[model samples]
Target: MAVEGGMKCVKYVLFCFNFISLFCGLALIAVGVVVQVSMHKTFRIMDVNASAGPIILIVVGLLTFFVAFFGCCGAWKENHCMVATFSFFLSLVVIAEIVAVVLGYIYRDKVKTMIDNNLSDMITNYKVGSAELRETLDKLQETWKCCGAQNSSDWKDYGSDGQSVPDSCCLEVKPGCGNGTMTDTAKVHQRGCSDVMSIFLKRDAQWVIIAAIVVAVLQLLGIVFACLLMRAIRGGYEVM
Candidate 1:
């Protein structure tokens, strides 16, 4: 009886919701991988825990994927046990997603602060830093097309030849191109990499937050539908 009438509609909705959730899980995993790569590329010069945020997202995404599989099977089979289990697991996924979002937000702020405080050191370390570190900074500047920690002048103290910027900061690249051009706006990038990259970092973080929040909100409907379907099945309604 419970599966008849509107209960039938509820059952189908539950199935559709889980279908969407399967894709949602895949999306979360993809986003996490992208963000993880960006974090390492952008903040590798600093001491940020670049893996933690993305790892959390990926784990939750895997959980969501498997739970949605349970949901789809249960809803289709009219099985009470699987439906109940699906609801419980979906509830946990929602919570885990929220937590992942909060952690991402916190990590974003911490990275921003770390960049501000450590940019000087990063610039100073260019000559002394390991090959990997120098390459990362060079790529950072070249990709962002920005100069020093704060501006071109920030390189005035760099290397033995003070008042020179890296060739990576040149408006037009050539050997020793940044020599004696610390504040030369026409020759080297004038903006700071910290300021330039921060904009992109913030934008990425916002997308991650929005994605997680949207998925969490949407899954609530699935949870409710699963519960109703479970109820219908447990009542011995013989849901078709």
Candidate 2:
């Protein structure tokens, strides 16, 4: 009689597990699909480095869907064999999730390192270019200090051919100089550059955070469902 009573409880737990798993799995799949769609362009054009997390989420979502389906079907059938099989599968999935979480953490560190490296390079280049500009400005200041009072007489002696001037001398060009290094320099200093980079970096960080949270939640659910399914299997065996 006690065995029968326990079997009834196990059956109930299995049913609850199946229902919860189904809902969670479908929700995760939906979230993955949404994230994938929204981040497609960013991964394709702006930042390839951050793309892996979403893709992993998609795979996990699909796997969860199937796992939940199998669990639900096995529970509904009240078949000990089927329940045992899926329970084993769920255990394996939990292991895989653990491994994936570890890898995701490692990859997160790598992403941070890559971002740091890129930022360092940008700062280095910007400083070098700025120093060059500063040097030119300083030279022009010195020249003006010595030549200002003398006016055009001093200018005439120096000749208009800028070639005669030191490379450190500043020349005023037509407003629209041919787009060359000057344009590249402008791009580095553009207000938009920092904002764009910040947005992209933030996106990457967001994806990482999402992946971590999703994995944690799924792992917890998997463990709970697996235990429920195991109990159901034991109950079915008792019924036999």
Candidate 3:
């Protein structure tokens, strides 16, 4: 009787843990969708290559959902084999998360240089680019409150007749703000796009890293619960 009662307790506990894992999986997918949409909207016009991080997240999310489902079924049916399988898959997920965190850290370190070079090229070709490209650059400058890729002086190199900066750099919207001599710091932003964008990228990467860590912790918990339930089932509980 005591053994049966203990197994029941284990089953319920495992069920609850797997239920939480189901929601965590859904949340990961939602995060992936949000990241994909934001990245596509922000960089589509700049012709920048999209990162595969979001897609990987979505794939992991789906895997997590299925694994959790198997866990729940295993616990409910008191099936040792199914519970073992769940633990195995959950371990794989933990491994994948570790890899993702390492890759994310590396990418975060390298992204600043990539952004600087891309922004420089975009700024240099802004005048002759398509209207969509121009609009994208204007929005980026306005959003970040920055001027050229490095500094306002970067505009001088590409400027015709010493007027290269776009009006988007203006402190206030007004005519001829981008024109005339580039020396008037009062009218335009002093900070460069690279500085602003580097901060933004770092913040984004930090959030991803944090999320990956949280998910890994949750997976670890789920594995613990699944393993415990497997032991309970092996103790001779009838399969439901």
Candidate 4:
């Protein structure tokens, strides 16, 4: 009887976890879509290629949402088969994430090699040699002063590794060759934590709304599942 009751409790807990996961997955999907759309707009001024991460994020988000839907259905029904099925899907999602991380590691050296090649090209091609590069850099420093006065520290740091500076920042320089022209542009292309934070802040209100909905849904679903599973377990144990 105790074992039966414990199994019932475990089921309830799993249901609750699934419920929360469902809501979180949906929220992530929504946020991913927003981020992708925003990236499109930002890419026009920045680099369209810069959006690769968001695009992948959007796909992953959608998949998560789908998986969450299955989980929610499973929990609602208290169907062990359905819940187990959903768990299988979740496992796949975990595997995919692990694979992504591994691929990133595997390709890291290759990425670095490409960046080195680009930097070497910059040093060799120097259309105007290092002297002109130095003068251009000085001009950038002067511009930084102006930006600083305007309370924009954006100009103070030079982009590293394949990162593109906005045209506005490097407008004075030859096209395709300014602060972003450095070999480090490749490195800069990856979105930083700050970039992710900016995206979140930009959609703060939307997230708040979505979060509220998710929380409410999860809570309601969790309670319903917990009570139902508890009753089912008690009955099963009594029969034992």
Please state every model's RMSD to the true fold in angstroms: 2.2, 13.7, 2.7, 12.1
Model 3 C-alpha RMSD to native = 2.7
All candidates: TM-score: 0.89, 0.53, 0.86, 0.45
Which is the winner by lDDT between candidate 2 and candidate 4? Answer: 2
Query: Could you tell me which residue pairs clash in candidate 3?
Result: none
**lDDT for predicted candidate 1 compared with the true structure:** 0.81
Best by TM-score: 1
Per-residue lDDT of 32-61 in model 1, one digit per residue for the tens? Answer: 888788767675645466456677778877
Greater-lDDT candidate between 1 and 2: 1
Model 4: per-residue Cα lDDT over 139-231, one tens digit each: 432333211111223323434543434232332435454454322332222232223333443365345445545544544554455455545
Task: Give per-residue CA lDDT, model 2, range 1-240, as digits (tens).
Answer: 135566556556665766676676777778778887775543432345556656766677677667667777766776656666666766776777667656755665455455444433332343355664434332432333211111212122222442122222223323333123221332212122223444456576667657656755655665565566566556545432
lDDT of 2: 0.50
Tens digit per residue, CA lDDT, model 3, 1-240 = 246565567678778888888987898899888988876545542235644667787898899898999899888877789899999999998998899799878777676677777787887788888887788878888888888888878888555676657888888857677786466788888798888877887898798789879878977987887777777667765533
> Which model, 2 or 4, shows the larger TM-score?
2
Measured by TM-score, how close is model 1 to the native structure? Answer: 0.89
Rank order by lDDT, top first?
Answer: 1, 3, 2, 4
- For all candidates, the clash counts are 0, 0, 0, 9
Cα displacement (Å) at residue 147, model 3: 1.5
Quote the lDDT for 160 in model 3. Answer: 66
Against the true structure, whose lDDT is highest? 1
TM-score of 4: 0.45
> After superposition, which runs of candidate 1 have C-alpha atoms over 4 Å from their true positions?
37-39, 103-109
Model 3 misplacement above 4 A: 1-6, 41-49, 238-240
